[model samples]
Target: MISGLIMDIMGLHRFAFHSQVGYTWVILAFVHLVFNWGKVKAYWRHRFRLHPHQDLPTPPKQLQQLEHTQKSDRRSLFFSLLAMAGGFILGRLLPTGQTVDFSSQKTDGGMFYHQWSKLGYPQALRAILNWGEQPARYKTYGDARQIELPDPKGYQGLSLESAIATRRSQRDYLNAPLSLVDLSRLLHLACGITHAPGELRAAPSAGALYPLEVYPVVHRVEGLQSGIYHYAIQQHKLELLQPGDFRAAVVTAGLGQNFLGQASVCFVISGIFQRTRWKYHERTYRYVLMEAGHMGQNLYLGATSLGLGACAIGAFLDDALNHLLGLDGQKEAALYLITVGRVETG
Candidate 1:
């Protein structure tokens, strides 16, 4: 049983081996049960008092020894069952390559239908119920320093086809500092609001509920302090969150990916789930993840357009990044990262 559970946890699901072990275990259990039939009968007789008028007979020395052995076996079986159950639950919770469908028709939706539509909740109701006071479009810090970004309009010069053709994940970067104009263009194209009237942004969000937030970790940006800064999309500026260089900490959070610290700037994308959860409910998670992907792609293409190298990083310690950014893992958590810098040329 222990070996079977270990194989399952390691994703080594050899059907032939598992089947053989399973059948053998079942047969052994049956045989053991048959061998203990006398003890089983005696136990039931004593427990239920089926023979109330007949006094219980004392067992002989060998029978007592057998009873003792059966008790020990029962105890071992109980612990084994517990260990198997615990291993199964742990394996299910751990990350695996296999895709598991958590959605149910009753909760997620039916064919050509979703839970949001089934609820019959209007957009106006969502605004009133989910966000009564209208959540701020931009996040602000009280005493932290701020850096106003350059105009983003002047930075859009690259053609769409050219940017798409040249887009690639770049890991090697020159030891250089990115200019403020380049940083402005990257953030604006990635997530900044394009249309202020309807609160629309460069990336398409589900139901216009922009749940994604951008944080730029400045490593070597020219004219910018080395610190963690929150990108205020609406204002098109940076709000300093923490002072001092975090290149070392970022590398640690990124699981020793030294290239992360070499970038001119690293974008940390986080999601505020409740923003979308109010309307989509159980399906909110899917939208949040999709939104993150959309923003990451935008950053990639935007960096390419600006003639800078960009790499989308997915492998990182979730808790480490959250702690580095001063975010609670539940309400707001880092979902993705993008490192951008000048491409090294020979």
Candidate 2:
């Protein structure tokens, strides 16, 4: 079991079988203890010298043996504690040595990152150095014009099961304008602040560090300008980044997907790496992409629940989309795109 655990921690073996072995070992250990319950009880009493009157009168040789055993146990416990304390102190005092840059490694990039980010003893110790002030949770544009989105609550939509059953990647959309309320609800259900005190959202984030920024490139939303706008999650409002038509640019950025131009709103999801990177370190890339997936699924279900169409786009020109969103394609970069609009039904 110990060997399996070590292998799993080091990313040297699959954890499913290792975990099964561990669980089975635990069950066997439990059964062994059950069968030896009386022996275990007697040993515990002898070890701790509990209830001396209940124990048999010991021979002089047995008495000496017990004394020696007690002394050895005491020494073992003292040394064990001392070793733990010394290890902790050394880990804290020692500077982290040079870490290999996984990006420059000749190994497969994804596998290299996986192995490098594996949480082992050394990596856990190095994490102590990563502690400090956390980055701001929300990205804001204070000077940009903000549009008040309608109260997204109290809208009766499809049941959860129905939504999941009907949810699909819909690329074909009708040439009709989407209502402002529909847009409001979509954004709300996607990543709105669900718990105000904790600043939690509709989608779960790693450590609640919401690194995602949502930008809606409006094409035909009613009572809204045709331009790019950021969703202000804290205030539940839309912040207009640029007020102009970008249908052509969005289609080009989306690799000439005509459906992007046809959709009423194309949601661009970007991740601010430092938000999660400060805490997660090497695992930051994994967490940010996972958070993006959570947000994307929420959008998919939300669109489906509202009886609208939504399609996720992954094959987009990253640099082009980043440039369009005024992102530097480093600290904050576009990760995924989902286009939502009205769809024809039979």
Candidate 3:
């Protein structure tokens, strides 16, 4: 009664306050509850389907309440992100109302976008230069023979440190072939067998959710049949994918990058998110990228040690690549590409 009397004396309209602020809060609360209920219901349905026999409480009343709380938390986060995006877009778009005194500043400095223009990164990294002298395209597909070496120096000289130090993007190749032993060794070191004898397994996957698939593109590796091969890590052998000199098509798929053209072989890292995301839903994306990096580094180190060449490729025609690998880019989609070759030199 005292508080009511104090409010009346202040002439503060209680009905207006209640209708404005209280109504907004109640609406938000209702939406939050509804959003959470939907989320929890879907989760429960998926969970029930996955583990039908598990002795768990049915997700109706209590689960709805718990999910509503979580949804509230998530809504707050989403709104915060929306606010940031809105502010950033507004700032960028809004006109400068007035020009301030700028005599003290350097002439080169300007706004953020203008400053970006100063740091001249190549407009695009996939610019390809055609050569008049192309190595005679070896027409034969499935044949094994001793590979030809241009000079003994390319093969005889061997050191990991030197190999790494002198690495360059060399796409022009002498008409020499890559050896089978070299091919085998490269495959072993980059992506070889582990102790997983299970019918379907990959190198220690997150939640045993092995998500990566490796494919090799073969062009001029000798004593080994020329064809695309699947690295059977368990068997430590190549499962032939297709027989052809598909380098041109693969290089084109890789956005016409010259290094891919000169590469004797390449590795395509594919992912099966279901194998992982089933266990770790949202965060599985992070793990998948991390795993790709790990595999890429392995290729680099393995190539360095074997006195061969390897380069990780990020730019590629995503859809064409999927087609090149005969993949749908859905279930087991390629994540990374690595080109490997016997580095050519003077």
User: Best-fitting candidate, measured by lDDT?
Assistant: 2
Expressed as tens digits, the lDDT of each residue in 24-102 for candidate 1 is 9899999998999999888756544433434656556755665676677677868989988887787667554332233
Clash count in backbone of candidate 3: 1
lDDT of each: 0.81, 0.86, 0.61
Q: Total clashing residue pairs per candidate?
A: 0, 0, 1
Please give the distance, in angstroms, between residue 201's alpha carbon in candidate 2 and its true position after superposition: 0.7
Tens-digit lDDT track of model 2 for 1-346: 3333334334432335665876898899999999999999987677767335346777878678777887787788789898777766765565443333444556455765676686657567446455456778888899999999999999889999999998889999999999999999999999998888898899999998899999999999999999999999999999999999899999999999999999999999999999888888878899999999999999999999999999999999999999999999998999999999999764
lDDT of 2: 0.86
**Which of 1 and 2 is ahead in lDDT?**
2
Model 1 gets an lDDT of 0.81
The predicted structure with the larger TM-score, 1 or 2, is 2
* Candidate 3 error regions (>4 Å): 1-174, 194-205
lDDT of 3 by residue, 1-346 (tens): 3332333322232235644775798799989988799887886575445334348875777667666766676677689888777766754574433322334464332342232222222212111222123222111213323232121113434466776676654445555667776666655545454343543332345654456767878877776666677765544556676778887888898998877867878888887666665545444567787788877776776666565667889999989988887888876688899887776544
Q: After superposition, how far is residue 301 of candidate 1 from its true place, in Å?
A: 0.6
